[model samples]
Target: MLLQTIFYVAIAAEAMTAALAAGRRKMDWFGVCVLACVTALGGGTMRDTVLGHYPLTWVEDPYLLLICCAAALITIGLARFMEHLRWPFLLLDALGLVVFTILGCDVALEMGQSPIIVIVAGMITGIAGGIMRDVLCNDVPLVFSSELYATVSIVTGVIYFFGLQFGFPGEAVIIAAALIGFALRVAAIVWKLEMPKFVYDKELR
Candidate 1:
């Protein structure tokens, strides 16, 4: 029940953040809702398509679409105040990344996917929506260069999967994994920690 509650909150949070992105682009209200739906649901949609999971998440639960659209509209109404909540949004985004990863792993486990595939699913769920959002917004995708975003996803998934395999209580595993991933993300942001980038100024040898 706790997990499910957090999942709904994360979905709405994702939609709200995506709505803000749409506002930054000066998108019309319709465009704002569209982007919100895509950014909040696109990752799971891609994951379901890849895994042959039928009906997709929003299709399975149409209310999810309503939640996204409603969140987007609320964001549109509160646009000015949102600009001052960058850090809070970042924290929420970090929380969403870990929660989504754990949820994705659970889906893969239900499908009897291999461990690697489970981790991959978690990573996809954590980052792919942001990638799609960036593409639509005409900005470089932050997941490609952001501070330990996908890394946190993978770490959270690993901890989640192994914790279950080791017979830990589900609630304990979820909280531990989420706390670790969230702290890692917050640290990365504060310290500006990033993966090594390959810079190619000249032609390759």
Candidate 2:
């Protein structure tokens, strides 16, 4: 039940993020909905496909698709209000990232996947949607350039795995991992923490 609730929250947050991106691009309502769905569901779809899980979540539960569409529509109506709530949205996005990471890790664990596969699945579930969103919007991917975004997911997955291996209660593991991951992400955003960028100096060559 807790996992399901977090999953829904994650999708809503991701959908809103996508809607905001669409608004920036001045897309039509239909385009906004399409992008929102892609942002909310694309990652899970990709993860399930790679894991050979049949019947994707959105496919099996059409209500989730409706939720994404509704979120986009609501975002359209609240564009100005949303613009003023950037910090809130950033926090929500951080929460969503943690939830997505937990969900991905849990799924892989249930499937008896190897440690590496579990870590990769967590990353895919956490970042694939944003990658697709950025590509569609013709912008640099947040995971590629943002402060410790993808790294947060990978670390969170590792933490969750170790927590389970060490016999932590399932609920405790989820809550602790989510809180830690969200905190790291929020701190990165607040403190402007980032990985060093590599700039190629062609002139030197």
> In order, how many clashes per candidate?
0, 0
List candidate 2 stretches off by more than 4 Å: 203-205
Candidate 2 lDDT (Cα, 0 to 1): 0.91
For candidate 1, lDDT tens digit of each residue in 24-65?
999999999999999889889988999998889999999999
Best by TM-score: 1
lDDT of 2 by residue, 1-205 (tens): 9878878988998999899999999999999999999999998889999999878878889999999999999999898898688998898888888889888888899899999999889989999999999999999998888799999998899998889999999899998898899999999999999999987868854
Q: Enumerate residue pairs that collide in model 2.
A: none
Could you tell me which residue pairs clash in candidate 1? none
- Find the candidate with the highest lDDT and give its number: 1
Query: What TM-score does structure 1 among the candidates reach?
Result: 0.97
